[model samples]
Target: MELLKVSGVNKAFGGLKALNDVNLTVNEGTVHAIIGPNGAGKSTLLNCFVGRLIPDTGTVMFADKSLIGLKAHQINQAGVSRVFQTPEIFGELSLLQNVMIPTMAKRDGEFALHAFKRLDKDAEIIDTALHSLEDVGLADKKDVIANSLSRGDKRRLELAMCLVQSPRLLLLDEPTAGMSRADTNNTIDLLKRIGEDHNITKVVIEHDMHVVFSLATTVSVLAQGTVICEGKPQDIKGDPRVQEAYLGGAHL
Candidate 1:
């Protein structure tokens, strides 16, 4: 059931160690969250997994393949996709077109420069893109310009774009970074539905305790570059170590 395995991971810059001996395993269909204080190296660890950073030492195995030396695109092709904290959709493009780019790349392996060439000519790719948008409840906004949509809709577009890739594992970095309470709750609901229906494992790095509690089946708390504690949400909520290190002694 383990789809991704990371062991003995370490990354450092100069004399400061960002991640030290970090070990994590993500099963095929579950939501795993990594929570920590501001400087606990959560983003650094995520970069290592998605090929944005090369660790000083570690082994990352995805679907039994070594992912150490692969480039970012190679990692994406190897069935892992990541969504950044900020929405990465192209503001100039329509919502549907933003999703179409990945769909075309997945199928044709290249970004054709001719806008005149209809990407929707491929029935399966178009169908998948539309379904992905529908999953995020943005199917009705397909023709809206990406920049014109609200912040929450932009996040939904980003999710739809990632979903079009059909990645086995999705890495989300604070999917609700700057949003209203209503928007944040909507995102949590979308993530829960995705976990249940898409069959994709998720590794989320979140600072919001509410979001973490709602979406994470398992939580790992990091402090000063190492894991301080890990367990189910209920146990983590009651753990003194987690509370002191990251939750500020509050039962979040």
Candidate 2:
């Protein structure tokens, strides 16, 4: 089944066409990779999905519901979670406390239960947060300050934060960005585990070909604001259109 449907999407900044009649469909429980060189409007398309940007002319449907005008929190509540290119976490909070934020999140985007206050009322949230930490391989660091962790650990924490929300759709922007090869491979293993454990559908926007080929079940190559080719991993690897999109050549 199609989990997401984006049709006739277009975005422009002044005369610059960021997205031009772009269309994409993501199947449920599949890791769909959106790849391109820089300035191909991948970010803009992701923003549109999460309500950060409203397309000039298009319909983005999640489970057949129109998502064009929903607020970010509302979209999040509707089971769409985004992991930004850079990890975003509370620097002063402990790892466990940070993971609890999404679980304790009120509808209006506030924490109804304070981290220190109402411990009894927060028991369920706290337990879930701890479990999420364990799943992300950060259980031992639960009490450590968020800012003290390495960059890779920070990324894992952010993923844990998103996972606790139980999102049906996870949007990842360069999830392994700036990581050493070991860390990158670790991330691939982590994602593989998550896919096995959850019924989540993923749309990953990544520049790393290794990461894309390793994790993606399907790939869409975009250039000049349009998707020029899309297919399975091996198919995309040999496609002339896909090659030209990334290697500085004319659009297909």
Candidate 3:
């Protein structure tokens, strides 16, 4: 039931080796979190998964299908969606309209803005958007401009955008990076609800231990471009290698 796998992955920039001989496997329908210090190559491994970076020698597989040579749009079309560190949304559009855009995207990377459907069909699209909005707790603000939303709401809007695609695997990079405690906890609840409601597999790169422990079913700890340890929440907490990874460095 492994949904994604990375084996023998290596990445470097000039003289700096970001990832070295790394291997990982993510099971279906679980939140797998990758955590490490600032320079542990956590993001480097994420890029390998999403086609943003190709490793020097490795296999990146989603459902056993290779992803190394695919383009970003191609990766997205393959049912892998990513939520960036920042909220990526249209500031000028209403929340509903913003959600409508991705639902209108064709698999070939073109936006079918003018492919007007029948009235009933368009109405169905609207209903879909509304339901997605409700899923993210934004149904009441469907008509509000995206920019007017608070920081947490903006993040929720981004989640709604991704959900509209019905992605089988969702990758999140620091989903709670810049939120207050209440917002962060709320986002955790939202993600938990999302997992239960949608049955989506999630791969998250996170620095917040609270968020990681709250949502992750499995945790991988990386240090100096290699995974030093990996285990369940309780196991990772008491791991001496995990302790060493953060003892002399910055928090993760």
Number of the top-ranking candidate, with TM-score as the measure: 2
Error of 3 at 136 (Å): 0.8
Worst 10 residues of 1 by lDDT: 243-252
Backbone clash tally (model 2): 0
Angstrom error of the Cα, residue 117, model 2: value is 5.8
- The better-scoring model by lDDT among 1 and 2 is 2
Please provide, for model 3 over 35-125, each residue's C-alpha lDDT reduced to its tens digit, 9 standing for 90 to 100: 9988899988999888889899989989889999998888888889889898889999999999887776623255444546563367767
lDDT by residue (47-124, candidate 1, tens digit) is 888888998998999999989988898898888888989888899998888998888777766445666766668688
Q: How do these models rank on lDDT, best leading?
A: 2, 3, 1
- How much lDDT does each candidate structure score? 0.88, 0.91, 0.89
User: Going through the candidates in order, what is the number of backbone clashes in each?
Assistant: 0, 0, 0
Tell me each candidate's RMSD, in Å, in order: 2.7, 2.4, 2.3
**CA displacement after TM-score superposition, residue 170 of candidate 2 (Å):** 0.4
Could you give candidate 2's per-residue lDDT for residues 1-252 as a string of tens digits? 999999999999999999999999999999999999889999999999999999999999999999999999889988899998999989899999899878777222533444466754667888898999999999999999999999999999999999988899999999999999999999999999998998789999999999999999999988889999889989999998777777756445
How much lDDT does candidate 3 score? Answer: 0.89
